[model samples]
Target chain A: MIDIQLSERQEKIIDIVKANQPITSEEIAKRLSFTRATIRPDLAILTMSGILDARPKVGYFYSGREAMSFFTNQINSMKVSDIKSLPIVVDEQTTLYDAIVTLFLEDVGSIYVTSEGFLTGVVSRKDFLKNSIGGVDLNKIPVGVIMTRMPNIVTITPEDSIIDAAVKIMEHQVDSLPVIEETVINNKHGYKVIGKISKTNIVRVFVDLCKNN
Target chain B: MIDIQLSERQEKIIDIVKANQPITSEEIAKRLSFTRATIRPDLAILTMSGILDARPKVGYFYSGREAMSFFTNQINSMKVSDIKSLPIVVDEQTTLYDAIVTLFLEDVGSIYVTSEGFLTGVVSRKDFLKNSIGGVDLNKIPVGVIMTRMPNIVTITPEDSIIDAAVKIMEHQVDSLPVIEETVINNKHGYKVIGKISKTNIVRVFVDLCKNN
Candidate 1:
């Protein structure tokens, strides 16, 4: 793939085609006060780039394909697994106070809670802060009690695109998502947390996109 | 601007040019076993897209410009002011408990602290959770006592590119950056918080990029 910055005359040629499509090259040349030969190369570049469509006997037609289509294609090709990070997981029996310590040690925004080795819930710093300040006995209560449980928690899978993850993060207004995989533990259907995709991960991808470019 | 997916013949032409520098079009056509007229359009597209350079007599040279340059250009053109959100600011005298309430109310990742209307410090959810569990009297202590103070906070200006902001956020390992401008108040030189760019903002930008495309 290659990118081309269109010249002023080429841009003007596109405008002419958009306004008077199906008009032959001779008419386009006449409008710009140039001969057919002088504008042939411009028409070739436009059609080859998919910005204009040409028929055998007809003139050019504007295709309206923006330069961003290439960017969109690149972004769509990146999967969630490509950028996901390790999830901080804890057992449901772990006390809230202990989970908070794990959050600090890992320096992550959220933690995944598992029961019987299957995903059950998720808790974030906000939840910890709210409960801690509300005079809850952090040592006595289990993390499972305060977490946003399954069916309510937003999630993503490894096959999902990074753009899908970003959309879920924005639409759900959550800091991160638990990347899960379908599983059955003792014949009970559940999801097992495999990875995590957060706002931080998305930001990192954005930076890499520019740096790599 | 336009994007072009190079044809198979164009790809072969690039490979040939990279292997043999200053190779004339006649030589290129001979290697491909095609007449010069047959590959003229392919060569025209390659040179126009800047992937190859054609000299008067020296033939063709590989330019090595990738398709990603357009992506980089779009990102660099976006300024912090274009996507920055409103900053959540609190006075230095505000109590830690009150600040936490403000944080929860605004649902922001970090809060900017101002002393007499100039940025002085910053605090995140981690800081709040750490202090709240450390036996500190949340209602009695001022927010200034625990904030990451001036000269230590990462900041961005309105004119800085979004890429620069993302770079600083990743490098500093911070959740957000306060958009500031130089100011003088009471003979004190300091920054006045104008807006904020956080991971959320970057993620939103990422989503918008794909959506707009």
Candidate 2:
């Protein structure tokens, strides 16, 4: 993680930039009740950090990409609770048709396959493709028939950082993470999903934070 | 548009906030080679504009969502280039299976469809689903056969704001935007596929921009 250390003064300057970027340093000094001469040095430090862009007469602006990197560098600070939405799971007994409809309506790319109420496997859009583009029976074939089963699953706790979660997505080459309460990912046992986190959700959180940066 | 006027001091504070947030007012004073006493009031004024958030000890931060809202508030300062990226489209003659696979591999939910290299229609997973779900010939059928024909599509340009792109996604119930070079979409004459933009992309961009803060 890049420990972006900002002195109290530097921090205050960043706050000001975020508050009114694509602005001028002279104007900023007036608003913060500081003098242009005082804020100038601080602005220089920020520019050196590649955190802010300065236009002589026009003023300064924050680079959105740069600002977001500062926070994500330490995504370990994020908790599973930070991503609170739960995912709707499907039973292995569920049919292909149901899975398709569910996936579309929920706007998710995959679903956990469970038996009773525990996760047994995972089925994705790719899994559905193997059988079609043909009309087929969703009821006859169990979701477990195509799902990538336990022991091969990747799960995260509510306490995991956003960076940790992002790594899993990249490594697994999967679109989403099934947040589990308890994990014994083996065929003999089962994975119980409590919630879900997708690449989209992670991105959403960062974007929201940047907006407020 | 959110025409909140900025005092010179307020502008400086905003600049600083953008440079580095999760910062304290005391830090701002030191960096500018000034005293914290001088920066507090200015910070307070900017915060009152609803552009920055100041937590007594935590310092201040920027507000991006509010900025996005302002972009959407009117056409005055709003430009298509703001939210616009390049465009990406596929040939109508392309097979359905190939398109679906491309969408999956690219991690994108939709792709623009065209004929003779001109915009003609749009094919989304949902559009494919109603027919693709049943056992059918994704290989044999041309994507043009299933895509949403041109002139009926909703799109935006490079000058538009992020909010405009977002609103289009929500309104069309579509997940992405295929930035088109041509003002008019012709099903038979597809435009050059420059880049792709999506809600997911927006989220990712934001998360990336504010990772540090």
Candidate 3:
């Protein structure tokens, strides 16, 4: 894929096409006082880029497709699994202090809480700090006691697009999301935390996009 | 700007140009068993998109420019000031408790510290969480006692690109950066906090790019 800036004449051609739908190249050229050969390349670019649709005998029609659609397509094609990081999970019985320690040790923004190897809740540094300042005994309280519980946590599956993950993070005002897969634990349904996506991850992807470009 | 996926024949034309660079259009057409007239549109596209360069009477040469260069240019053109949020700031004498309160009240990941309207330090949720768990007297210690002080804080000017901000955030492993402008405060050279760019801002930009596209 390649991106190109439209020349002035090409822009004029689009304007002309918009003003006169199904206009033939000859008419377009005549309108601009240029011969058909002079504008053929411009027409080719506009049509090839999908800005203009050319029917066999129907001349040109505006397609209304923007150039940035390529950017959107590229982002949408990236799956969460392609960029997710390993989630830091702690058992429900683990003390808040231990969980916080794990967060520090792993340098992760949030920790996933699991009960019997299935996702139950999530705790972030904000949650930990809020509780820490509230005079709670970090060593006595279980991490699950302070977590945002299941069904309330915003999550994404590996199959979801990274754009979907980014949207959830922004809309929910959360720092990170757990990438999970639905599972059956014994007789009950649950989600197994498999990966993690955070604002940091999103930023990394953004940097990488620019870097690779 | 527009992005386009090269057609099969267009791709073949590029391959031919790469191998026989400086070859004329007529020669390229002969190799592909097509008339020059039939390949004119493809040559126009390859040359216009900068994937191939055509010199008058000298034929075409591989430009070696990738399509994503447009994406890179678009991102680099965005200035930090274009999207930086109002900085959440606190005075040096404000107690850690009050700083934490400000952090919550503003719902920002980090808070900038100022002394006489000049940036002096920065404190993040992680710092607060660490001190909160350390048995420190949050109500007694001033934020200046715990913040990552000047010269240590990674900062950006308003003129810096948002890409620069993202790179610094990722490299420093920090949640946010203070947008600062140099100033003279009581004859001491320092930076005055102007705005802030955080992981959240980066995510928002990423989302907006996809949305706009």
What i-RMS does every model get? 2.6, 10.4, 2.2
Q: Model 1, A1-213: lDDT tens per residue? A: 677788888999989998998789999999999988777778877888778899989878888766455677789899999999999999999999999999999999999999998999999999999999988789999998999998899999999999999999999999999999999989999899999999999999899888877
Query: Per-residue lDDT for A123-183 in model 3, tens only?
Result: 9999999999999899999998999998899999999999999999999999899999989
- Measured against the true structure, the TM-scores of the candidates, in listed sequence, are 0.81, 0.57, 0.84
The lowest-lDDT stretch of 10 consecutive residues in candidate 2 chain A is A65-74
Ranking by TM-score: 3, 1, 2
Tens digit per residue, CA lDDT, model 3, B1-213: 888788999999989999999999999999999998888888888888788998999999999876565667778899999999999989999999999999999888899999898898999999999999999999999999999998899999999999999999999988899999989878888789999999999999999888777
Writing each residue's lDDT as its tens digit, candidate 2 over B21-139 gives 97788777777776876665556445544667878767788875343222212323544455454444678898988888776676556788866666777887666665577556779
Proportion of native contacts kept per candidate: 0.76, 0.11, 0.79
Measured by TM-score, the strongest candidate is: 3
> Given candidate 2, what's the lDDT at residue A206?
47
What is the total number of backbone clashes in candidate 3? 0
The C-alpha stretches of model 2 lying farther than 4 A from their native spots are A1-78, A105-107, A134-139, A183-190, A210-213, B1-88, B93-98, B101-108, B135-141, B159-173, B183-192, B203-207, B210-213
Off by over 4 Å in 3: A6-68, B6-34, B50-68
